[model samples]
Target chain A: MQIYLPIAELPISIFLVLGIGAAVGFISGMFGVGGGFLMTPLLIFIGIPPAVAVATETAQIAASSMTGAIAYWRRRALDFKLGGVLLAGGVVGTVLGVAFFNAMRRLGQLDLVITLSYITLLGSVGGLMLTESLKAMLSARKGISAPLGRAGHPWYFGLPLRMRFNRSKLYVSVLPLLFLAILIGFAGAVLGIGGGFLMVPALIYLFRVPTAVVVGTSLFQILFTMLAAIMLHAATNQSVDIILAMLLVFGGVFGAQFGARAGQNIRGDHFRLLLALIVLAVGVRFASEIVLRPDELFSLGLIEIRR
Target chain B: MRRAALALLACWWAAAARAETMVLSLSSHRVQITSTYTGAELVIFGVIDNERRSVTRQEPYDVVVTAAGPRASTVVRQKVRLGPIWMNLAQRKFADVPTTLAQISSRPIVQIASPDLRRRFGLGLDSILDPAGYDLIYDPTFRTALIRLQREAGLYRSEERGVTFITPSIFRAVVPVPATAPLGGYDVDVALFSGGVLLAREDTNFEVTKVGFEQAVAQAARQHPIWYGAATALMSVAFGWLATVIFRRD
Candidate 1:
């Protein structure tokens, strides 16, 4: 069956959208990733406008991050003190990011910027993950623990505004944490991602936070940042398609449940390897799209739709 | 609604009487786009007065029907090789371009009329762009690219031999409304030709509008966008919470 999306002003097959949402949600649940990077490109490939795809996918990220945040809250894994400091910087980053996004859109450079950002970020993240997981797999076969996460102290530890985080059991500099949050928040707003993939590693290695607490803290900050992003996109660009978001959420919610269960059976190193491969494949696809010549050079843009 | 329909019919009749050659009528004058609206199909039927000419079975009549949606300004962009990647380099703004254009004719448009005549009548995709005062620095290939892209999107289309003659003077054409069709007034033009010359032309238009739930949703997103955004965020959060509650593993 086909359903008409109101804001996008198009009709898409119901099953096709649902299936896309479910598959993205499954990966998100299994890997604890928001999957916005995956979903946005797929939606654009299927003919949704690039602007609408970017704006609407943020709402789905907000939804999935909310679930993860609440679960972490129940377990008392979230450090509200640290999250608060990060959110303060995140709001600033979101404001600047939205302004930059509007400027790029006006110049008609948003698509190129988004595609290039995705290629670079995904390429690096995937490459790092592949090597790390392979090393872990090798170490496991030899029955020896991998000497990872020991890069000594981060350089920013000596920065100003040092504060103690009770839950994380660390006395980290607030300035660096706030700066990292701002950078990730800017990326989240502009790239339409949850920034978890970027934040998790930063929290673990740079801040020396425990792995147990990093995921929850990242989710908490992402929830707030995405909330700001959705509202800003709606107010400024008017690109949020609620009907599209709802359809995606319906499938995503259910798929996440099944994916979480499926994730328990797979070994951690193997799961990371699979996710890295998928990410790398998506990055390669995006890179090739830019490198290859387009089938058609000129494309139409609808300036207005008269009612 | 009935009164409006009657008024439109009266107006069409008045226009037809002035031409005194052909009369055109659509199956419906209004298309309601409800929540479940995927697409629509309308049938256009018309009659041509062949008594004026001697009917020797020598090409009785040729009918061409065009359904053109409301005109709007749009931009066409071209991608160029920028270093190692492709990027949008050149763009042109066109005024008064139809949002949706579907042409159905008894035979191929090229066979029916000359290119000059077709351009004058605004019959085909080639004539859609108005280069009146705009600079012509861009290559004509840009226009071809625009048409190709529109055709792929199912917006601009020309179906040769789409019109069928039920009788000698009576003909009907099926006009398909694609799912991506914009909401607005769509003008349907029916031209009767004899001996490769235009006999009479009838212009009738229909309104495609969003109604019910679809209207409400689209309106909210446009008008009360802030509240709509808040509501969307809140609902998403609630949905996420509900999912976690229902599917707790441990």
Candidate 2:
């Protein structure tokens, strides 16, 4: 079946979009991560205009994260204080990101920036995760346990505005946490991601937050940040396709149920390894598109005619 | 059962002795874009009505039908390789170009009319896209790209054999509107030509609109943006929450 998207002003196969949503949802459920990083790229590949894809994906991320955040809140795993601080920083970052997005779109360079950022962000993150997982896997085969991460105060801890996060059991400066949250919010708005994949790792390794609360804290923050992105993108750009987002969320929510059940049989290290490979493959594919010579050097776009 | 398709116009030639009237009708005047909309084809039927008292001519008559969708400004960008990556470096803007244009003629437009006459009637795609209105210094490549791209996208087309004549004075043509065709009013012009001279022309218009839920949603987004955003957010939350409840019952 074919469906017309109002904001994108195009027709697309209904099954194709639903399938992408399901597949990405399955992977996100299995890995316990928000699938926006995967979804935005796939939507773009399937011929959705980048602006529409990004803004619409933000709305999906908000919906998807709501489920995870609700579960975490009920389980008492979320850190409200930390999540609140991150949200405070997220507001500032989202505003700046929305401004940057509008300007880049006007200059006709939004596609280039989006493509390059995916290459850089996904490439580095995927690479690091791959090596770390492989090392962890190898040592486990030898029956040698990996050492726990040692929490240490880096130079940033000495910065002003030092604050305490009782739940994470850390007393550190709020500067680093705020700065990281801002980056996450900015990426969520500009790149159409929940930033949980990036935020979880940063919280675990950089800030040395407790593993028990890291995922919950990030999910809580992502839910609100993406919600903020959806509203701002709608108001400023008028590019969000609610129908498209609803279809994706429907497929994803259904698929994730099966995926979570299936994931229980797999080992933790194997799960990480699989996710790393998928992430790296997406990055490689994007890199090749930029490097390879394309068949059509000419492209078409519409410019608003202001009176 | 359908309504009668007859829409008559008496377009008179200068000389009353040999004057001819053009009568035309369209298959449909309104196209609705429902969820199942794929594409549509409008078959235009027309005829040349001449008073039987006039002397019959040896030369046969030809009919040319052209349809243009609503106009909008367009930007065609060319990518140049910069530091190992291809990016849009140069762009040319064409203001108020037809979103879609389809031309159907009984014979090749070139064979039907002289170059001067063709240009005057705006018969070909090139003539329709007059480049004289460029805001910047003109370049032919951009115009070439515009036509090439639009043709490939099925937005612009011309078919010499698309129009067929059942009789010398009676004719019909088909205009293909792709699924991606924009929604708006469409103007169709039917011109009569004989021996490289313009005889008579008639014009008619149709509309493409969205009905049902599609229309409501589009209206909400444009008219009540803030409320639309809030409603979308709430609906998305409901979809998400509903999914969990249905699937994760444990």
Candidate 3:
């Protein structure tokens, strides 16, 4: 179906859109990550204007994450205090990111930025996850137990703004958390993703948040970041496409529900590795787009319409 | 066990009995069109069958087209509403969007479907058609018909459809393009409705190109390479440093 908006419009199928949402949601639920990284690019591939796609994806992420957050909160898994600190940092980072987003839009460099960012971040993260998981798996086959502990580093211990997270049993400095939030927030805006994929890993590896708290905290932060993004897009670009958001949300909710249940049957490490591989595949596709010359290089300003 | 088996059979029979018998069929399994006309003519060709019982009088059905964006923020919207016309006499009724069929056909066809059936088998219709036991037809001559419609709607062609349709059911309409068209993407919505209710909606995108912008920028950037590179690098560093400062943990 085609929906008209004041700024732009694109034709889309309700079923296909729902299917995308379900797919993204399932992956997100299974991997304890947000599916924004997947959703944004898919939307662009389907011919959505990049700006509208990103904005709408944010809205959909907010709605889907709200559902997940509520469930987590009900189970007493949410760490509101830590989530608040992250959100505080996230909000500021979002504003900055939005500024950069608008500047790129004016220069018509937004697409290039998004493409480059996707390639770099996805490639690195995917490579890390794949290597680590493979190593762990091989060691496990030798009857070795994967070491689990915190790194005793002066950098982490000396950072200012120390806070205690009772649930995770950690007393860490807030600076690292804040910095992580900002990075994730910038990524969230630039890529039109919920940033949970990045945030969960950072929390686990950098801040030492327990795996249980990581997902819940990331969801909480994602909810706020997306809400802020919606408002920013609405105010500046007027790019939020409500129709697209609703379709994706409908699909994402059901997908998350099914995915969460299915996730219980799988090993977390294996799921993480699978997700990382998928991201790597997508990154390779993006990198090829940049490196490969097209049969016909049609350019209109910052937009390249390929035949 | 026998009683339980009998109960299950009864439930299955009850569900099967509740299915609708009347069927609707389109001449084409799919429809595709592209045009640049502001107001264009559109023609949709389809066939309907009353499978259970043939009525002496023609029944009314609504022909609707809807469009939505291919992204999450985009919405499912109705582009045109036509309906309740006598089915037999209006076997091939035309629905116009006031703009022109040529303009509407100028964009990609995302989906095409009918919604009256229980399963909603058609491509575009969501709430309007049943999915099972219906045949959608595609006519070869429809492309020529679309061209003729675009000529009637009054616009020059800029592009053509990248994909082909395999269905006999087709939809043709005229859409108007604003003079102040921006160089960006737009969603074209189409759908079919009956009795003030929506059947299905399809969305596709049409992009406006801003020719030469990339070349112009490249030329300018080359003229001031060092300055451009420095400015870009500085901005990136500043943004990165600012982010670090603001989001610092403590």
Expressed as tens digits, the lDDT of each residue in A1-307 for candidate 1 is 8888888888888899999999999988888889898998999999888888888988999889888889888898898888888888887888888888889888778888999999999999889989989999999999998875766666788788789999888887889988888888888788888888888877876787888888888888888888888999888888888988988888887777778879889998999899889889999999988899977677777777655
Q: Which pairs of residues collide in candidate 1?
A: none
True contacts kept of each: 0.79, 0.57, 0.00
Query: On a 0 to 100 scale, what is the lDDT of residue A267 in model 3?
Result: 80
Q: lDDT per residue, candidate 2, A1-307, as tens digits?
A: 9888777767788888889889988888788788888999999888788999999998788777887777777788999999999888887789889889999999888988988888888898899889888989999999998765664677887788988889988788889889998987887788888888899889888888888998888888888888788888888888888889888988788777777788889998888888889888888888887788878878888775222
Taking all chains together, the TM-score of candidate 3 against the true structure is: 0.57
Q: Could you tell me the lDDT of residue B22 within candidate 2? A: 88
**DockQ, per-model, please?**
0.58, 0.43, 0.01
Q: After superposition, how far is residue B124 of candidate 3 from its true place, in Å?
A: 35
Estimate, for each residue in B18-57, the C-alpha lDDT of model 1 and write its tens digit: 3337778799998888767888999998987756454343
* Candidate 3 local lDDT, A1-307, one digit each (tens): 4332323332345678889988988887676667888899998887678987887788777766776676677678889999998998898888788888888887655777898899889999989888878877877889997775455844764687788888877788888788888888888887898888788777777767788877887888888777777777666555665556666776776676677778888786687678889889989988776666533232222122212
C-alpha lDDT score of every prediction, in listed order: 0.83, 0.83, 0.57
| Candidate 3 wrong stretches, greater than 4 Å | A1-7, A149-151, A301-307, B1-250
TM-score of each: 0.92, 0.91, 0.57
Write the candidate numbers in order of decreasing TM-score: 1, 2, 3
lDDT string, candidate 3, B113-184, tens digits: 223322332222222112143335543232233333434423223222311223323334333343223333
Ten-residue region with minimum lDDT total, candidate 2 chain B: B1-10
* Ten-residue stretch with the least lDDT total in model 1 chain A: A147-156
Ranking by lDDT: 1, 2, 3
Q: Model 1 compared with the native: what TM-score?
A: 0.92
Model 1, clash count? Answer: 0
Give the local distance difference test score of model 3: 0.57
